[model samples]
Target: MESEELLGNLGQEENGVPKKEKKSPLISLEKDLTFYADSIKEVAVEIMMEGISLHPIFIAHQHEVSIGEVILNKADLNTDWTIQASTLEEFIQKGIIHPDKKEQFLKTYKKPENYMCVFVVVPQGANFVYYPYPKEK
Candidate 1:
């Protein structure tokens, strides 16, 4: 019996190794999404069971959180971040950050040290990474 293939043309060879894939825009998205979709159930289950860990950095920063916040998004710097949300709302509500720049600031909410990065879950079913604060002098 012949096996059916799921995508693109038949895999080709190059220099004795299988060639890399060339994806169309839609195919590119589907490939990425299909991979995640395979894990979505597991992720949902894990979130439901063990749940996510969070730190309350805002509690201490209180009325002065202009410095912003960060969280670890990858196992190491060599990898891209799995997530990178921010404390724009929290900071604004606390009067540490301004509301006008919320969208701009959130766009650049960066990831922190791999060892120190951890994410905070917002009420909107998203994440905002929270990293260990700098040590006081």
Candidate 2:
């Protein structure tokens, strides 16, 4: 049987609704990481806008890559003083992010000349604040 046909058969059910495959543990973990990453970004941006200096830590992932596959085995956030760095190499040397994703992370998170798009972790229960970064030149 062709691959597409075989896959269709695997998902078929008597009621005609395709049966969804169970998510692997790794996928579940990736989803969790994505959720946390978003939360951290939101909080970090807020903190950044309040005139408070932040050194937030983050595990940057490529936008083209599914978050469900990005590994976070070594990411460690300080929560208290995490600051956004300009390069993946900084995080990699600190052991806060995995080195294996260096290429994709750099490609997705930074602009040319090493300008970084901010993403960072913050302490839980931080007061909500609205501060936006000025448009990049």
lDDT measured at residue 55 in model 1 versus the true structure, 0 to 100:
17
CA-lDDT, candidates in order: 0.32, 0.36
Tens digit of per-residue lDDT, candidate 1, span 12-127: 45667976655433333233323333232333233335533121222111011122332222343222223222333445664444678667755555432211222322211222
- What digit string (tens of lDDT, one per residue) describes model 2 on residues 9-107? 232354887556554333433444444454445544554566442333343322221111122333464221222322334445544346886666545
Residue 16, candidate 2: alpha-carbon lDDT: 82
